[model samples]
Target: MDFTPAIKLLNSCNTVLILSHHNPDADAYGSSLGLALALRGVGKEVVVANQSGKVGRFSFIPGFAEVVDKIAVNNPELIVFCDCGELRRVGERFEQEIKTIKCSTINIDHHATNDLFGSVNLVDEHASSTCEIVYNLLRDAKIDIGKEVATALFSGISGDTGSFQYSSTTEAAFRVATELVAFGADAYFVACNLWASRSLAALKLEADVISNLKSHCGGRLVEGLITEEMYNKHGVDSSEADFIVGRLRDIKGVEVAVLFRKEDDIWRVNLRSKSTALDVSAVAAKFGGGGHKAAAAFRSKMELESFHDQVIRELMDLFEG
Candidate 1:
């Protein structure tokens, strides 16, 4: 889709507020900082913020230090939201400001569940990641994407596409990679930090989660649950648990993989499908959640056992249907 409206809107703004999703991932930082730095290059007063705070792994990206833990804006002429499927995905703190945003709001994302909340909504579900969309916007705006710009974009692509291992990796994504490299993106740094730099705590979390893995549907599905006890034992927190689903998805003979984390009174659910026989996003939507076909997620209010049973039943239906 043409990103002219977003380009024009961006060019028209003087001071802009840029925000990314909660629990920010590679794509979140990639798109947010890539756009934020580029806007600053054009002399725009830019505020790049993520409610989850800056992730250490992504600190290699330029402008990562500037990503605020919270956004503070009184009356921005433009508010640019990147990579979030819904406003709530950006964290609950933004709810009041988002409602009263008298300025033009721009929503640019790749999530299938995006609600088109922006005055200029640029949602391309088929794109490999929102970073891809942001890349195009930068190109259209004729921004000079130097080394840092390329690095931020590449980090996002690598993050969301599972370092080019996920099904979301597309030919276009690779093409964009080539262009970013030409613009001086550091691929080796991305690999070393984003993938190879896992802490001891993360390794323990992975080992513990795998030891407790469960399987069902005759091995077509596998799951792992991380409770506060497990996190405490591993000397990690929910942030380190992000890799659990990837581990489960690697098991042989598994078509669907899930990872659940008990956080307070709710369970955070993550889903992945290796086969086309299921649309996991539909499964997530059944519980007011949304994502892509191969990957999706939702939250559960039921007790751990109850939510486990409920999700397993849905997985069975997805297979049978």
Candidate 2:
């Protein structure tokens, strides 16, 4: 990908506001902070801001301490949004501010559903993660590939690719991972930071969440519900509910898996599919949400059973046709 225009835009700016989506995943934080570190390396004034969700386990990634929850700069000369499929992903307040920013904007993302909502959209749907795209951009700018940058990029790749187990893990993705590793990204450190440090409470929450797994289409599609009641009972935050969805996706002969998690009266429907032939993003976009093909999500206000029925109907239609 030719990042000449994106680099020119970044080069022209003095102060830039860098951000990712709310409810950030590793790719979100990694791409946003990776770009932040790269921009800062060239003496650009950069602020890496997020709307919500604690960095949690991703704090091991460099530039974690400097991630701010709000934008402080009055008039940033440039704004770069990373790993967000939609421009409104950073929550309502941040979206409002973005509408009024009269500066060059760059949207960097790997999701196929991205809307190209930037002055320069550096979107590559085939890229394993947004961090992969960012790594190329950094390379285009002749930025140094240090341990910190490598770890940040590697973390995103590990996350979005499920440690290179997902279908999105292409040969190019592996090559990039190899390069990042050679640049001093500690394999032990990344693995430990990503999965080796699960707390006992989190383990219990995973078991509880998995216990609710329900099946549709003769077990071809499985579902799970994590209600607020369950969260309060288990004394677990919403983040603790993430692990069970992938487990559901990996079930033998299951093509799609869904997790309906209730938070503040909203059922954030998380969907996962291991089959590349299955475009989960299409289903998610129908419900006003967007993401990668294998992993996507949407939020619904309908009653749990009604929404579950709707999801089943949609998947059945897609499959039977």
Candidate 3:
């Protein structure tokens, strides 16, 4: 879709609602809030709402404290969704709520798996981040990229690309980052706060996860488990275990890295790949999960050991095939 008409529509809407998916990551909140602030800069009444609550670490991003939840969603002239591919991922409860709306809707995302469910889908699977899409939209509409907007966009870009370490980091991403910096985005501050400020509990979880690491396929694939017992022993929550998989991926000769954590009665699998031939999202989609090619996740009903075996078998088949 040509974003021109929707940009014009945005200029006319008095009240606009911006939304992201459930358990939103940095890119989701960043893109949503960036667009919200940009719209507000042009005198549009915009609300940034997500299906879930705050993502603790990313609350440092400006406008995060003011995020509206699903309950706050009211009838509005315009609806814009960011970083979410499909309405169902936003939360099944709000899918119909979103569909029933009769106004012009805009869907912006960077996921290759996007459902293209929007009346005006601005899905760019090649873009490194949704913030990039939003940035281009604002530029195409001739909107100014002020400090707040630049900061938010930078956060989304930096966070999703793993602070520019991931393979998705392209020349365009760096060019946008440079422009955002010129617009007064504080890269150092965001980098320090988001990555360097880990709690002791998180450190302990990291150590435990590393200690339990297992390798297979001649060190090409690595796996780690952070069980409930391990969490209790370390006195840390599962959220603190978020970065453990990165450590496994750091090991030399490891092409694929996976971490399995017990969340209540379910098993959550985080998958990462360093090889272009491997599409981790394909592995994730088998179990109803979806994400980018390099990084993907899925949830399973099987027990940890059972799920571990199943995943290993599947991965072995992929490697052998």
In candidate 1, what are the lDDT values of residues 167-199, reduced to their tens digit?
A: 888899999988999999999999888888888
* Candidate that scores best on lDDT: 1
After superposition, which runs of candidate 2 have C-alpha atoms over 4 Å from their true positions?
A: none
Tens digits of per-residue lDDT, candidate 2, 1-321, equal: 779999899878889999899888888888888778877878989999998745586788889988888777889999999998889888888899778878889999998888899999999999999999999999888988788888888889888898889988999999999999998888779888886776677678778867777787888888787888888887877876677789888889888998889998988999888886787878888888988778889987888877677776776655674
What TM-score does prediction 2 earn?
0.96
TM-score of each prediction = 0.96, 0.96, 0.93
Looking at candidate 2, the ten consecutive residues that score lowest on lDDT are 312-321
* 1-321: candidate 3 lDDT, tens digit per residue: 378877877887889888898777778988999999988888888888776767777877878988866746567888898998777777666676777767778899988999988778899888889998999899889898898889889999998888999888999999998999999889997798778888888888788778878899999999988888988988876666777887788889998899988877878899888865787788888778888888888887876766567777766666765
* lDDT score, candidate 2: 0.85
Evaluated at residue 139, the lDDT of candidate 2 is 89
**Alpha-carbon RMSD, candidate 2:** 1.4
Worst 10 residues of 3 by lDDT: 312-321
Better of 2 and 3 by lDDT: 2
lDDT (CA) per prediction: 0.86, 0.85, 0.83
Q: For model 1, what is the C-alpha lDDT against the true structure?
A: 0.86
